[model samples]
Target: MICYIYDGSFDGLLTAVYESYYMQEKPEQILRKEHFLPDFFIEPIYIKTSKEKAYKVYNAIKDKVSHEALKYVFYVFLSELKESSTLIYRYLKIAFKIGKDINLHMHNGIVLSVHKISNKVTNEVHRMLGFIRFKFLASNLYYAAMEPDHNILQLIMPHFSKRFSSQNFIIHDRKREIAALYNKEKWVIVDMLKADGEKLFLNNNDEVYEKLWKQYFSSITIENRKNRKLQKSYMPERYWKFLTEML
Candidate 1:
């Protein structure tokens, strides 16, 4: 009935792992403090986030385990799945014991779960690279919006930053209300409000371009060869809201 509560950050989660080892106790659940609900029977222990302690666990996963294991651990964290903290904790325990061979043991449920969720997050990142449709605002900044299944704003920014390095752009995750903003030199993730995002006005040229793009999209379609099912498989209905052609 022992549970650990943390600050809901990657470093905070790592610090919880460090505390478990430091205290020599195994917690049944490791949850973010904000998400923790009081239980009459369970004893919840709050773990403070420490940069030094977090780094200790982080380095151990990379040095003791494989660097790829560290990457999988991070992807799982970004997934925001329920009981993900506990899942990661169990995965790391097995990883520490088996070292790099942990990846080879997909037969293990913990290893398999970690890999599966990590791949789900990664696949979304790959899909988003092509699916992102940017429009020019009145301020000349390029803007794009998405509501992905995972928290992948920071994950996909490196690609856009390189591809559009000469121009400023904002990739907004509407679901998370957070954005990755690049100013032609450096990129930073910041919290943005719905009103703020909605206020971005498209220039006349951009509006015309959107109309032309939509027309081109329709012109390229063959009525007889159209496959709605196949198109839905590649471009899910959920993403249609942001696609100009779909609109």
Candidate 2:
């Protein structure tokens, strides 16, 4: 069984998909290198990231599945699942062989696995819409930082861009170590290793806003009826670190 390892980028995943299809030999499993190699006898194929091949694979999928299906694949990739690459390959192979209705194969093992990953990433995408707090930076650029469990900056960009069309901003994902920067007219992403952000007001430092937010939070909590477990389930403790209301 062939074992494929990727750099864990969407383009990289796409390139790997392109190679797998061209090679006509589907692998036993696809894994990210963050985890150590399994005890099994492994034949490794290191997936090289190439935008050209990536775009070709994208067109191949778009030829079979609707654009919406591609979006679902994007969300699934954000989940960073170890088996995501293989599952996407499986999904695409079936999709291309069959027609558009092939999406009905959602119940298939690979398709279902991909949906699970998409669901998790989609949930995080929704939460970051509300939980993220933007700080005013010099040059009129409003900025916020988060260490989201999923790679969701792109998912979160359009919402803010459409709503705040006149503003310039940046949303950094400290975990994935990338940031999306919007300059009022267009949006672009950059890695933090190349960023110019300093330790300046990285967290919103308004005392009054913090106090008012805290008061509102306390006021809203029904002490006697509070279900801490339910609250924690919805808003995990890890996410609270970057939320102003929680701070």
Give the number of the best model, judged by lDDT. Answer: 1
Error of 2 at 29 (Å): 2.6
| Candidate 2 displacement at residue 180 in angstroms | 1.5
In candidate 2, what are the lDDT values of residues 1-247, reduced to their tens digit? 7877878778888888888867766677666667438656778888888999999878867776777678778887777766676777777777777757666787787767777788889888898888887767555668778888877888899998997899988888877778888888999888874244545455445556557777998889887998879878888888887776777
Alpha-carbon lDDT, every model: 0.90, 0.77
Return the lDDT, model 1, position 156.
96
Error of 2 at 220 (Å): 4.9
Clash pairs detected, candidate 2: none
Candidate 1 residues lying further than 4 Å off, grouped into runs, are: 202-205
RMSD of each: 1.5, 3.1
The candidate 1 region of ten consecutive residues with least summed lDDT is 200-209
In TM-score terms, which candidate is top?
Answer: 1
